[model samples]
Target: MSNLTWQIGCVRVTRIEETLTTIPLTSFFAAATPEALAPHLPWLRPHFVDAQDHAILSIHGLVVESQGRTILVDTCIGENWPESNPLERSALLGDPTSPFLGNLERAGFQRERIDVVLCTHLHFDHVGCNTMRVDDTVVPTFPNARYLFARTEWEHWRAQEDPGFAATLRETVEPILAAGLADLVECDHVVTDEVRLEPTPGHTPGHVSVRIASQGKEALVTGDMAHHPVQWAEPTWGIAADSDGAQATRTRQRILAQHTDDDLLIIGTHYAPPTAGRLVRRDGRVRFASG
Candidate 1:
């Protein structure tokens, strides 16, 4: 468990970590190269990047407690992918013994207590824990929660024929729908008065970042809109998993421009320690200043 908590006005957000590891820059960013990343290494090192310059990625779920609602945003990779799974074999290597549930409990969020399970988009890592195996059958992990999926996002992935994504969807999302626990909603569906979906398409056609506003304070839970802090300065750099790289870049530019120097707390969904920060202009470029 990362055990990181942030208070946005009256709402409480907790980070329940699933995996923290270093990924080669090239493996994550399509345009990343030693020369292209060298300039930003000075500010990115010791946190966002390791000594070897690999990108430090944290796979975690953000639990938002707002308006008497315990809404979980983006369930991290659960304990389901087997070694023989195609995605596990090629990209992840093997199934991880993730302590996600135990950590969630320690963070004081019980599975049945969660009122809503919100997925930004239907990706393997983001939605894996939507279901878990019990007695050789996969079932909804949060039996009492209403699984929220952006209608556009659900439609896109539901029609996808890609083996890796299809496999993940079958394991994680389909079961929830089968159980009648899913609510296919619009991109900007409001989860609560303090928390709502902010449509940030491009990573996927319907990818939505979480927006939290309470008592005049505000924060944004970035859902792969900008994965690494480096994107603060290099918004054009697209992740390899992006469904549309050009659109993703445009979305980053628009969101970054809106939040730059605006005092809005930007909580990265994949950032390492000190994941929450504010954007500022430094050396004529936007930089994420962790507080």
Candidate 2:
């Protein structure tokens, strides 16, 4: 695999896949079943362990580097999150792959070098790698980095009563806050000349996309606007996990519209390798330029 890849500037980007599993199509859409997802089989088969069908399973992470700082956009499902669904909980914890931290080290990024860790939202998969397990102690993976989060999102999730939410706040977020390392800002906050956060709510109350602009060139790190490129073609196809499906579709429509005519590079949190791409119009509709 290539050691480094860039997106129009000094910003180097990396895509890391965490796990893959399938779900019943009916769970996400009515009148859809295992057979209904068959049309997507070709696009998903090779990535799954053994593509067998109700749906395709996949999760990913993005690492962004620019100027003198390294930032992780989102963390995958952490090691010990307890899912209410027994099957999912088992698959999450029992997967034979590896500890996510090892993958970071393999990519040549020590946790200490990450000067900032940002999440588009507070979903479990996006915040999993926030902490590391060390001899029964869970600590921030990037000990020297200030964890940045949307102020509204943090406050909203912080008020939730779930154990996982509490674990993320108390064990991951609050520790950084207590240590004076949490930088909570509004959705449109700009962290640097090369990067800024654009509010794209609906998936979560405070979802935001990270925009990287330099030398008059631009790239948008779309956190979770549309989970799959299929959504670029079918704007109404939202995942069951979305907090606000209608709003998510509207957000996707606006973001997609902005990039459809230009050579705007897009990086999706759940997109596969060479995950970044250009958006173009075709047949009176927008399509992601896959490579």
Candidate 3:
């Protein structure tokens, strides 16, 4: 398990770890196909840990506590999610006695205390805890908070017409909407003066990164921009979930360049513990200086 740290501001941000599993460079680069990945394979081997385990990706979430509000940005895969994808589902189930709930308690938050819940996108991993099953019906996980979502995101997924998509809409978003507890806002919506949304699409039709600013300092909660630090070094290597690879690449480059020379901190949704760090440009390379 990695360590956790709190970065204080108008948003008292907390980094919470759920689980970490390493993936071989092969599995990740496989998306590149044999022809494209062959030359890079040798170069990547040294940086990656070998095993039946190469995907050392950690499933985690960011809890933004601002104005007495405990807002969870994304919920890592929840326990017992009914997905058939073994690797993801296995990551979910691997922690049979996960300290997620306990960790929240220790950090001084309870489900009922959360004032708003926001998800960067509707990926299964990002919104896993949006709802939980009851005796027969699904219900909002944050009983008293209004869940926020990007308007375009909800619309795009709703139009997909997939059965599982419908299930997620019904089980997670619709119920919250029905209870008048869902805030569907545009890409530029501001949850508060301190917390606002930045339209960082491409990963998904409506993916957005959260921006927090206070005391002349700021941080961007980059939800899945680059799954890990390595991606900062190779922005063109898009993730499998990205809806538009070329556009995603453009957005990644823009974000990295904009923050690389400045003092802005980036809190990657999947970054190793504490997850909060700064981006730096060295020589001709960029990397996350995890702080």
Candidate 4:
């Protein structure tokens, strides 16, 4: 619930945090071991790492408001999910005891007031809050909002047989579809004048990074293309969850190339504190300039 807000002309963006966790670098990036992170430790510590040398990541919700529409990008992990879920045991451990509804309220975003809900992919943390538990039944958290999803992304997960992910799809995604609130859209679909989806797949088959531009400023809300700032520095690192490491690396490099040596703010979906930053070029290498 930090007072984190960004303004880009007529657009306003805010972060409603659910939890912060420190996990092994290898958990996400297979090549980013403790020894590999040794040189970056000075810059990464005190904010992006803990005493135990684990990399820190946050799970939160981004509230974007523009043109009389309030949109939420990626609902953080909600409580009441099954314990057997691997993602729940990863780092933060099962939603971190927060009531997402109250966090949204504290962020000045009422559940009913949300005009649209966009999921970058069908991942557990990204879609956990899509529904809420009312008594014993799960239902749409944003009763009036249209849940926008990439048709390809939906179909990929929908055709899967994994019990854990399927449970997440059942409770978090299917309920919205059953309620007739789901809007399956193209990967590049536009949400508002200043906001639109940019297909940056590979982490998931239909992954996308959101772009926001207004006046002369711009920012990218990276869904899962690059989960950490270090990826910008070393684009070849492989992420364990990515379906295709080569494709994910390509997407990461593409985004880095666009933001490096520019003013584009890159807001990482799971980046640690001061989560929003810009990519810079130094000595022909990429560096992160925090906002």
Number of the top candidate by TM-score? Answer: 1
Name model 3 segments beyond 4 Å from true: 1-3, 30-53, 83-87, 91-99
Best by lDDT: 1
Candidate 4 lDDT over residue span 141-214, tens digit each: 89989999999999999999988878889889998999999989999999998999999989999998889999
Tell me the TM-score of each prediction against the true structure.
0.95, 0.85, 0.86, 0.94
Return the lDDT, model 1, position 273: 87
**What is the overall TM-score of model 3 with all chains considered together?**
0.86
- lDDT string for model 1 (92-163, tens) is 423456777888988889899999999989887789789999999999999999999999998998898777
Ranked by TM-score, top first = 1, 4, 3, 2
Runs of candidate 4 exceeding 4 Å displacement: 83-91, 94-96
When summed lDDT is taken over every stretch of 10 residues in candidate 4, the lowest stretch is 86-95
Q: Model 4 lDDT vs. the true structure?
A: 0.84
Looking at model 3, residue 186 earns an lDDT score of: 93
